[model samples]
Target: MDNIDKMVGIRIKTRRKELNLTQKDVYAATGISNGNLSEIERGNVLPSSKALVSLSKLLQTSIDWILTGEASIIDNNSPEISNIEYGLKLNESEELIIFMLRSLPLEEQLDVKNYLRAKVAKYEKSELSSTSNHGKNVMDGNSEIA
Candidate 1:
């Protein structure tokens, strides 16, 4: 890999470690594949835009940091999507799911989203049901309820 690639790779690996993420974790969330991720982290291969976008979101950093190492963090509360970075470890299923979701149209994606939301809602409901099964109440308290 070239110097820029090497530098980017180092930054990705460093941030991932800082977050205590394993390669499996990242793979699960980003769907870049463990082997491809390893190469990118090693600076042996340049990452694609899709990969970069997914990585940024998962790493909670920024695309700028991964590519040019300019910015450090992404504004999570911003109205628009920031170039956040994410590269902690991920599992294979999670990675593929993330990858598949990223590739979907907004409308179609809603189905998968609802499915996931139901899963979370079910989990939350089950957990709190013992006390008070207020499903909406539980989701309301989550900052990331969406």
Candidate 2:
């Protein structure tokens, strides 16, 4: 197997161990079949991008995190998590979330929680500042999406 395949296998095995889940559970969640998932996790075969996305979701991590161990996709200052891309294609939200987690160190889950809380506070402060500047009338009849 190539590097990518090996990485996939390693990530699958790690997640399975962490979650106390079996290959069967992954198969059921990803609809990949036990034998296939096993082979993929063993680095006996390469998985398609679609299958990788499914596994990422079941594992609750991002494809980028799984494949490259990089959680922040675009690496901007905002905590607005970006989408996870598989090569040129992109994974959905669940897959992206999983991929992001996969990139995180085992000890950093708490860090992520703290980071999210701080970002939420920053957003709330910004909202309050905007509202106060506009006064009561500006917000009274307007129903604008933030």
* Predicted structure 1: lDDT: 0.75
Off by over 4 Å in 2: 72-146
Candidate 1: tens digits of C-alpha lDDT, residues 3-63: 9999989998998887677888787667788899899989999889999988887677778
Please provide TM-scores, in order, for all candidate models, with all chains considered together.
0.55, 0.47
Model 2: per-residue lDDT, tens digit, 54-80?
767656677787777666333322233
Task: Determine which window of 10 residues in candidate 2 has minimal summed lDDT.
Answer: 75-84
Best by lDDT: 1
- Model 1 Cα displacement at 142 (Å)? 44
RMSD of 2: 11.6
Backbone clashes under 3 angstroms, per model: 24, 6
> lDDT per prediction?
0.75, 0.68
| Pairs of residues at least 3 apart in sequence or in different chains that clash in candidate 2 | 60-98, 61-98, 61-99, 62-98, 62-99, 62-100
Off by over 4 Å in 1: 75-146
